[model samples]
Target chain A: MIHQISVFLENRSGQLAEITHLLAENGIDIRAISIAETSDYGLARMIVNDAPKASAVLLEAGVILSMTPVCAVEVPDAPGGLAAFLQLLAEAEVDVEYMYSLFTHRAGRAYMVVRVSDETALTAHDIKLVGMDELGLK
Target chain B: MANYYQPEIETASYEQIRAWQNERLVKQVQHVWDNVPYYRQKMEEKGVTPADIQGVDDLHKLPFLCKDDLREAYPYGLMGKPLADCVRIQSTSGTTGRRVVAFYTQHDIDLWEDCCARAIVAAGGTKEDVVHVSYGYGLFTGGPGLNGGSHKVGCLTLPMSSGNTDRQLQFMTDLGSTILCCTPSYAAYLAETIHERGLKDQIKLKAGIFGAEAWSEDMRHDIEDSLGIKAYDIYGLTETSGPGVAFECEEQTGMHINEDHFIAEIIDPDTGEVLPEGSKGELVFTAITKEAFPLLRYRTRDICVLTRKKCSCGRTHIKMSKPMGRSDDMLIIRGVNVFPSQIETVLLQQGYTANYQIIVDRVNNSDTFEVMVEMNPDMFSDSLAKIADAEKELVGALKSMLGIAAKVKLVAPKSITRSEGKAVRVIDKRKI
Candidate 1:
């Protein structure tokens, strides 16, 4: 699943708000986002409801966007649930570049979006896969 | 080729050149000792008199003038002539602190322009060529020095200054600028921008004179290939009348010192002992003919080697290789010496472009050096593992070359910030 996408942005005030406003105006909801900034510019990675539509809207808005396929794994809402998933990835020699927690309307279940180095190994572990719409993000 | 002062100074026999330098050196020493108070006081402290310095061989008895001495004399303390007589003033951009100002009387300016003209002619420039000088004006020495020199050579000079790349290229193409003068980094940036805008063939630039910062040999090759122009290195300091202290001849082997105007010396940077020819050390110069600020043995702090071998172009003035590093800019990391140029050389050799940043920070009282290099756009699609491997390879290369451990981070294309002028290559974050 295309769970996470990274967008490059120039580090200027109102840039992030402008990007988010454009997405909301186009009816594409953002599930979560994280920003990494150096001295001059920023890079924003976000998980959105509709990856393809969000990308198109961003492109038309004159924003550069890149999409990467990340795993959306469902885990029990317990203390070590997230830690257990990370431990599995660590043991598999897979580097997790970034991860975000995802909440769902479904009871007693939690989903996490993770972009990792080894997608094949993660998929081969038989982790539950969820789509953009199934997460109620669209 | 206008009839500029082609005094055959370069190819003059060694004995004849020595005689000319000796006569001028004695007169310059007497004038400085009698007129400049700074030199008088220094000589008094050292118990040296003008009579003691008879020839160029006796130049070592005189005291050296380092940057601190220049700073102490601040705006114009070292000038031997009155301000009204000074035709111009050029200075180094004191990005670190106060600027080191150099004054030039009409005579000094003429000599400086003559040196610059020699550099232009050596690079194949002629009266028919339009020389575009993009070195920044105002406090910076690059602009006015080249502008005056181009005019002296009877070439149509463009005092375009720097920046506004669109206008720079427009004028360069439309006006048929044949010789480009600016910092090497800016030249590289211009070349990149020109290719991106699909105007490579429109530019008529045949030669480039690049300086103001130390650049590697690989950078010269890159700029030459990208801009389709031959790049030459010019060395000078604001303390010694701007960008004409030495220039490359047609041989392009090294920059030939204007031995007629300035006396060159290579000294051990730490011990202050004069080194034999071909030894790498700090380059020191004494302005034997400068009437305004006649600095005696001003230490340039630039690390380079001098070669006395006769060139194919027949310039007998000793040639100094392009500076590899500045003594002041060397950083001590984890008990090992590190120079930004070393990393730059490694990066360029590995086929990486010159866009890199060195981040030095202290971790547990141990200095850690991290080099962040930008990947080429074509390599952006490589697998993360491959990218990581490349980064590791760079780290290993740096370690082996510098004999020090360093962390290498490979970033996406255009990730590192680019400067319109001199690129900020080093960021010593340990202070923060």
Candidate 2:
């Protein structure tokens, strides 16, 4: 299980840039990041290299944030990679909530952080799971 | 016995109040007619004279005096006394337009102080109490009015005008100040500071006379809880001898108008017809006993109601509910009269901060209303859907409260500019 930090943000200009800049300034690297925004507010979810360190830095800077459990899986870097993995999850009855790409990859494979309720279902299918330690510059 | 500054006047009978108003109203009318040609012309146009305005019932016959009249009568057009007799002058904050210059003779100052003293005593102030006045001094009437009242009540008046919270607390603790007099917002700020500095136990405030602006009952409770005092609301405009024309008693229901000094009447702002008791309308005041700057039937523009109901405090003076909104500042959004206070009441009821801004503009020949509420850290959630749901709930609550739909935008914390003085809560950008 990987720790994903989600921050509450308004649909404002320079806000995403502000968080990214804060992470860069604090020497915390974001491994994977995605934003889901509505007409009024936005939610930025990030799988940083060091989730606890990033959470502390952001919280210390008065940023509204929370951490949740997610699993990062390596998929083959090909056109059929995501579809095959999603089909495997469907066959294994792994209820995938949402998935987004990571900024870094290892050995010709792309990393996808998937929000799922049953991590055992993924493990039951022999999926290769990656933790926060193996994501970025350790 | 209740602690009253003037027992005879505070507990005056309605008949006695009527008798005093009748005598003073007639004389004030004559004074204005003789000394103020600006008002004399108004009377001539209305075909009424001092003789016509024989008593309180005849108050309606006099032509109404509005803020525009005060502006037009700028410096001396409304003076009921000669220049030499006028010893002091207090100007309004003038957030509206032209500043209303209210002249005060020595007698007027004495009476105004007497009004403030009534408020202090009503708030449980005594000669033994050290009154800390935090209302701004100089042209603004809050400081002077409360300061004079504290002196009149023989309280150790600290003449501490607004601002400098650290020093205010320093003096408040060191001198053992027992009564606080400032705007309600300032009182709240002081309460916030006292708790933050961990000096609430050191504070000795028994009562706080908060006025010069509108505040909610919830806010009163908040300040009372933090400061350990009964919060009383004092209502008065600079146009009508400053912040002691009416005051809240121990009942905490409504402020008892000093009916002998100034007569309060509710009137329809549009038609200028006086409304009956309990009918919420624009508050019109007749400064029957004011000598230097007598405003006859001054339309206060403050929307409120009046009640002569027997108060538990035993004051026969008419009690006025807190002014709901100013007719001048009332926003007519999409043909519905929307007051920022209505929005504030809804916000406070919903357990949100009062730090909100109202934006009204015209869009495509129609009105657009929006309320920008600061998204405090507590209300923020990691889920956007939940935050949107909260915004939608606020919109529903505001629509039901204001009888019109208002776009509620939860902006970032401190995105909206905080106010130091009177908070600019409404921005009407309609080009009408």
Candidate 3:
């Protein structure tokens, strides 16, 4: 399970930069990021290198945010490899709530962090779930 | 039981009420002509005189006094008597523009209080009952008018003077106030606080005389159910005498105008033509009894209908339906009067444009006031923290200016609709 930090941002100018600047100043690197937005406000979700450190600085800066458990998987970097893994989940009728790509260290391979409607159903799939530590980085 | 302060006038016959108005209108016209030069000059310009206003039938012959006229008069030009003769003055919020100060002689005060006393009595008040007046004192007439009336009724008067909800509830519980006097929003607030504090059963209130702002029948029911009291409506303006020019009797159908002191008329707002009875139009009042500031045919700008419907309460005075709306762009939120121009003034003063929209809605039976302002291009690029800080600053400025807290939201530039003609600046979602 990877700790995904979701930050609530008012749909205004430089909101993303504010969050990124605060994280950068604290020396916390964001490994993966995705944004879901509405006309008035938006939510920026990120899987950072250090969850506790990212949470502390974001909270200190008065950024409204929360942390959730997400399953990270290392899929083949090739398009057919990614398609084959999704087909297995589709065959099992496992609903993927949301999935975002991450920067992986190993060549010819990619990281996909996903939040599924039911994580317990993932045990039936043949794909292995990767841990936050497995994504090696300095 | 029927309780009327002055039974003779309150239960007067139709003919007697008409005779009183006719006689008083004639006398008041003569008085205004001789004492108020401003009004006299207006009448002369209209080719009319005191002789022309012989009775209530001739009320139309007189000139109309609107808010602009009050502004034109300013501090004292329209005052009918010598400044020394006036015992006191009460003023409007003046949020719209210039403040309107109404001069009142001691005689005027006595009559105005008597009118309020009539309201108190109609709301089941007595010497045994305690009257808690939470209307703001000083320049606002809501407090002093009801306070004087409470004194006149010989009830144990509590001049609470608005705000400090804890103190209001403390005294209300300890003193056993039977009659509550204030704006309906404050009444609703007090009711909500009492229920939340679980002191509902401890309250001994029997009735409330609420006015000085518009309230709906549904709100009246809400207040009644929450406070466990019969909520009554009172109608008046600082231009007249304040919250007792007319009052709701037990019938609760409409407010009865004190015919002896005032003659009520409905006129087409645009045409200035008098509308017949039961016709909805702008409400106009001719003050027949006020001495220090007698205004003949003063336009109230309140839209309502006048009905001679026989009330079960037995008051012969003509009843006026609750004001449906206003002819101008004035709004009442949380019982505090607000004008769009007041918001515009604050915005422009804060270096924002006049292009803003005021959204007023009733949520959980309380007014929710929000002002959505359009950010300039420069402001639109500011950091989120800076934008939020700007909103907070505006909230403070508006609260200080209007004496009420308002939520401020900064929106994208030109997001709010703009009109070439008279811009629609307010959107009130309250069903009532």
Q: TM-score chain B for all models.
A: 0.77, 0.78, 0.96
Worst 10 residues of 1 chain B by lDDT: B377-386
C-alpha RMSD by candidate, in order: 16.3, 15.7, 12.4
C-alpha lDDT of residue B13 in model 2: 85
Among residues 3 or more apart in sequence or in different chains, the pairs in candidate 1 whose N, CA or C atoms overlap within 3 Å are: none
Name the top TM-score candidate: 3
Q: In model 3 chain B, where is the ten-residue run with the lowest total lDDT? A: B377-386
Sort order, TM-score high to low: 3, 2, 1
Q: Candidate 3: misplaced stretches above 4 Å?
A: A1-138, B418-423
Off by over 4 Å in 1: A1-138, B1-7, B330-432
TM-score of chain A of each: 0.87, 0.90, 0.94
The DockQ of each candidate is 0.05, 0.30, 0.03
Question: Mind giving the per-residue lDDT tens digits that candidate 2 earns over B1-432?
Answer: 588989998998888889999999888888889889999999999898888887998888989888789888787899988899889999876432456789999999999999999999998888999999998898889999999999999999999998798899999999999999987767877788787889978988999998876566777888888888999999888899999999988999999999988888899889988899999999999898888999988998889999999988888899999888677866655434466777888887776788889998754334678898877656665566667777788889888776668988877665777678555798877543
Candidate 2 docks at the CAPRI level of: acceptable
B-chain TM-score, candidate 1:
0.77
- Model 1: residue B298 alpha-carbon error in angstroms: 0.5
Docking quality tier of candidate 1? incorrect
For residues B1-432, could you state the per-residue lDDT of candidate 1 as single tens digits? 222247577678878878888999999999898878987899999999999999999999999988778778886678788888987777655422335678888888888888888888888888998999998888777898899889988999989998899889999989999999988767888888889999988989999998776556777788899999999889887889989799887677889898988889899989899999888999999888999999999998888999989788877888999876666776645424466777888888777887888998754323568887765533332134444566567788888777667877665456577789566788876531
